[model samples]
Target: MSKVLTVDPSLCTGCHRCEMWCSLTKYGEINPSRSNIYVLRREPAVDVPVICVQCGLCINACPTGALKRDGATDAVVVDADVCSGCGTCVKICPYGVLRLDEDTGVAAKCDLCGGSPACASHCPQGAIKYEDINKAAARRRELWAMACAVRIRG
Candidate 1:
């Protein structure tokens, strides 16, 4: 019953609060570059929050075997001691969530804040949520059904 981070792009306001909290909590600084969650902004006031889905792609991509899933949280854990600062994991991440922290000299991404995600907890706009995978999928399906109903009625 591991929970996963979910994002609602439509509700995001590009506030970057999630990034700030993440950076502060993990690195004790306000550097967004070190934050695992990134906000991708587009024209016309669109903001999309990108986060790690813990898909294990980075774990497989790591040549030094630095990345692995935490058995307790199911979040990607980066072993800095074992990591060689290679960018393979960064490049192979399908969501582009992984990045090499210049200060730490190791690949960094969301570790779910050791189970409770700060990004989801501190989001001002309710754009992010942490829930069980099954519940999240069911919610998405419900939203889709509501959208389709609206379209049909209109």
Candidate 2:
């Protein structure tokens, strides 16, 4: 089964540990700019953890065929050597999670660390989780329904 990185925004504390783990694991440095995951804080103290959902939309958009889906992890990965640095994958990515690495000049995004994601594993708040896609989808729907019920009661 394919897994995805699921986010529970309510659990996020905006500590940016996920960013640190991702960068450190990938680049051997604690660089937030190089991290695949990003945390954006809203005005009302809401911190949103954003990452590639492994949607694979960019895989088809890549003109050079640099983007391919990992069958084992269901991750859309960019091949730096084959990538033309065309930025098509970045633009096509709806979540804006893809970027061109400053040093490599190639498209970069989450590869799920081959199977176990460092960001998900190191998240202190459990805000980010690596889970089966079906389970994640069901959980999202449940959360949305609960939110809607609360709003309706309000």
Candidate 3:
């Protein structure tokens, strides 16, 4: 079962707590540079968490083939031995999700905390969720419709 970490930008407070947790868990330090997950703030009022969609942009962009996923764990693992740290994947990520570990020089992303992400659990609001990828959007229809009804009523 493939699970994804989904985010509702509207619920994000731009606190970057997710960024702290992610960096602390993966890099053993509270360094955003090493964090795979980051909170991106854009312009007037847009705060969105940038994380791996597992859409394979980084995978496809990797020239050294160091970026690979563990099938058994469903976690994307980076092999530093083969990685050149050229930063192509980091450059290509549209979401600004992938980032270079300043010390290690390799890119990293949310590996779902080896199947149970701590960030999602630590999130104060219900903005983040670890859910089935196949049925990821199944609930969106209902949610959007409900929002639409509210708009009509108000």
Best by lDDT: 2
Candidates in order, TM-scores: namely 0.90, 0.94, 0.80
Q: Which stretches of candidate 3 lie over 4 Å from their true place?
A: 42-46, 139-154
Model 2, span 56-129: residue lDDT tens: 89988999999998888878888888999889999998999999999889999999999999989988888999
Tens-digit lDDT track of model 3 for 1-154? 7777787777888878887888788778887666777788997777877667766678878999988887865776778798888999889877777777778777766678888887787778767778887666775565678779989999
Cα RMSD (angstroms) for every candidate in the order listed: 2.5, 1.4, 3.3
Between candidates 2 and 3, which one is better according to TM-score?
Answer: 2
Task: Give lDDT tens digits, candidate 1, residues 1-154.
Answer: 8688888887999999999999999999988888999999999989989888889988887999999889999998999999999899988989888888999899888999998899999998989999989988987787688878989999
Candidate 1, position 153, lDDT: 100
- Against the reference, the lDDT scores of all candidates come to 0.91, 0.91, 0.77
Q: Give the TM-score of candidate 3.
A: 0.80
In candidate 3, position 137 carries an lDDT of 78
